[model samples]
Target chain A: IEYVEEAVEAVDKDKWKGIAVYVDHIDGVIHPVTYELIGKARELAKKINHPVYAIMMGHHIGSQCEELLHYEVDKVFVYDKEELDRFKMEPYTKAFEDFVENIKPTAILMGATPVGRQLAPRLAARLKTGLTADCTILDINENTDLVQIRPAFGGNIMAQILTPNHRPQMATVRYKVMDAPERKDAAQGEIIRCNIDSKELASKVSVLDIIAKEKEQFIEASEVLVVAGRGIKKEEDLAMLKELAELLGGQIACTRPVMEAGWLEAKRQVGLSGRTVRPKLIITCGVSGSVQFTAGMNNSEQIIAINKDENAPIFKAAHYCLVGDLYDIIPNLISQIKAGKTVSA
Target chain B: MNILVCIKQVPDSNKVEVDPVTGVLKRNGVESKMNPYDLYAIETALRIKEKLGGSITALTMGPNQAAGVIREAFAMGVDHGVLISDRKFGGADVLATSYTISQGIKKSGTYDLILCGKQTTDGDTAQVGPEVAEWLGIPSLSNVSKVTELKAGSMVVEMDMTHEIEIAEIEYPCLLAVDKDIFIPRLPSFVKKQETKDREIRVITLADLEDREEKHYGLNGSPTQVQRIFPPEVNNHREVWNGEGSELTGRLLSKLKELKFA
Candidate 1:
């Protein structure tokens, strides 16, 4: 069997229509990343000369579709029902899968989140399409193919991927990677109530409970952030970082290692697996910046990194790099701030 | 009960580097290790084996060298190993990779449960596990953070969806892509490593799979195309300071003050 690359011109490319963004919402509250996807989709739509559409799926989510109109999507498709009230993979996958089959969107963008990560793959399998996950950047080529760029192999390099031969080129963009467009005062978009098939709502998995793992703080809304990583020797070391965050009138966050060590709750971890934040100022202590962590916070207004190893990758991303033991430097910075002395360099 | 845990050998994440000029990854001699995420899946299987008394078969789809991960699984207490290796399977993407693994699983035999890491560190696509389940015609779940109940024919699990954690129950012969911290993954025992040093790893090649259509196996079956590769834009402006701890601390404080952060 010969391995032949499919010609880009082989498919009926013009048959695909609008750019679609999946609206991630639960209990009537939409995830902010949905708006970010809208913002990105708007940009990509302009490049490809297509209207942007938002696909909303959940029980009683029609009102949310109306709200999505404010974000400038040309159309909103709503699949609201009791079956979708809770997210079971099978039903949600089926709903979005059927929508794509019907509407034939040129591209579908989703948040690189747990639900998105889980659902996107299954749908791609069903459609026999291609999907690039955790994308930090999205662009449209002259040929109208969606160029999905993401950090690969532990963030060492960026890989630009394309699904040239497949319709509905899919990519999951990480939260905070793209800016969220402001909602307009008056909604102008049309909302189409999608009639979902009963069979598509069938699920093999049954949900038992939905609960918060920890009391949530809006890390995305924080003005200042202090994050810890593997540099912190033990779980107890998190307290010092937390105190620094408190003194600075900010919240505490961690790299994946700290959360995995049970020092901080997963909600407080700032990385690809966790929440994405764009604070006014972010101070990373003992964090060896990986693309996973940097992708979550690189958009912050200012970044200060404190690590003992001078060669740590965090320095490459930081606006201000401090090479020393965070254990020693943090206390001094805290006491100096308390003393009201100008410590300008 | 019988169990099968899927694992993969990936280039060590920390050692992967890209060439600045060519915009291609410099992969001449990078060392390979069991994917860090797969360790958790193996640990989960070992724990389940402890409670349920099941024989564990660790499986993978890669080159012959991928047998290293299977041996590592044996060091962690897997009873058997299988490496689905063949030249025709090279350069396969997630879709084809999952289909081939499903074919290998069918050839190996059936099991009550199948476990895999949420995603691989290299491909970073968390799709393979669920797609394999799709191929095998079984229910699958992802980001499963915890297992709360294990009944005779069903199991309940807590899935971490980031914003909220949802608990779900599924019947036997299902697939799960487990998340980190599901358990504190135990280190491979030195004693077990010594004992399993000579263990034979069953090799499954193209001839072993039920569907031996070569065209459906590798790059020919992959749909995604790589248009280009490059390094992400980095801020080149950086100031590295080296001094005594106290002096460096003072300098950092002063720098914070200069930036109005103090």
Candidate 2:
């Protein structure tokens, strides 16, 4: 099991040219985070005068290249092959290695999804580069260095990182953190179909089968979220919260404690450890706001929190705060909504 | 079967503060504990060892005090423990940290499987496990939700790929970073804790690693550098309401209506 280290060599910074976005997709449909990264890349590219490129790897994905061009990408590299259909770590990393060898991107952005998190590290290690994960902010400096800002130590402190010497400064950002660029009516990018050798796409792990889980509404994409916190006394109390969530045409979410209690699924948890959600309206009930909990949903458009503790830290992040018991407030609010007393604007 | 579980000691609370002037973590008296996620990794290793009859060795990289986590692992039924510590390894980023750990793993001995928590509570990068696998040039899997089967030379696992769950089989000498709730981690036994209190925890330093290049060990080896550190900005302009439940509910409904959320 012994491993040998390779000698380090200096690389010319000018050899890397463009800012590339990893276009993540399943089947043929594109992930929304792809456009968001493209949007961010377009901004970074303008400052450095570098081209914005999108590298997509999947089978039967040639048609999606034109759609990517609408997002102001200068070029789209497609590695469409049968072996590349499903995301096996080895094949995906190999294809991306080939793309990097040819394109020499100055910076690479990827969605902080399961696939991206797994792929980014392996690729960065293989290429001997640096990668900051789940970055909240990305900016390019005068020297074309990517400034990666991310929350560290459970969202208490924000750290700004730099890959000054790496050829392609890489970063993985979570979904909904950045805005997806507006789509144009006409496509304005060149599609370069890359032909990767079949041998290069070989993988060590074999897929036995893929079982598609039932499609449930993801809390990350929800426009409105009714969040339950540690103040929730009992597991059965979630039913009342569910009623309010459905009445508001949103979904029910919970804090880490509630999720760990087995009252809600892991995907429904909102916090640093869970999903980062930016809903149009987020209501927190009985949640004493720890930085870990508020960091995920503070970006929400309108936030309302009801907690018994007047000095709950969540109040600092909320637009409207109510100092009261959730047991009394939630029931009253449910009744008020049922009576149709509130008028929609 | 031989198993090596990677673990770390992190501050007990996430409320750890950073010094405003020095940009250094103010960790004078902050009690540290084994990262909560690593408990899952330990539990997974314990279960596999329980069923297959193997020795479980817990490994961690930190100061000498980090051996406390290894002792905790021993109380949870780990057979051996090792700590890789050196002042030269300080300030290492994920790249250098993983490389250092990989070197320590090679020195410790070979294992059929290497297990790790999904990520550390402090770094929260979820990158070290796979990067260590890469440095070792072995196949790795993340977000492994379930272990379908374990064979003599291979194991089957179901990975949560966000959209779909894919079951894949990987051969021995690979790494799998297990997610939380893989199993309800059992608490350390008081008896075992008392028995293993004086157990030896072998410590390895930078000089012990074969790659003794100073530039390849710590901050010098890391490509990424932390430029600045600051407290997160907070928005404190909020309207606080205190009243009867009925009155507050009515006001909340009106506010929701004004915002078109009703």
Candidate 2's residue-wise lDDT over B138-183, tens digit each?
8999999888899988999998886689899998889999999788
Query: Tens-digit lDDT track for model 1 on A70-109?
Result: 8888999888889998777788888898799889998999
- Which candidate's lDDT is highest? 2
The TM-score obtained for chain B of candidate 1 when compared with the true chain B: 0.88
For candidate 2, lDDT tens digit of each residue in A1-345?
122223556668788889999988878788889998999999999999999999999998877877998899999999999999988888999999999999999999999998899999999999989999999999999788999999988788899999987888999998778877878879998999999899888777998998887645989877889999989899899999999998887899999999999999999999999999998899999999999998899988789999999999998989999989888888878887887844421
Candidate 1, superposed: residue stretches over 4 Å from native = A1-9, A215-224, A227-281, A284-345, B20-22, B238-262
Off by over 4 Å in 2: A1-11, A214-224, A227-281, A284-302, A305-345, B239-262
- lDDT by residue for model 1 (B1-262), tens: 7899999998875546677786667877888999899999999998888998979999999988899999899888999999999988887878788889999999998999999997888877787988888778788899999989888998999998765789999988899999988998899999999999999999999998889988677876676777677766755556777777788778877765555455
Worst 10 residues of 2 chain B by lDDT: B253-262
Clashing pairs for predicted structure model 2, backbone only:
none
Q: Cα RMSD (Å) per model?
A: 8.8, 7.8
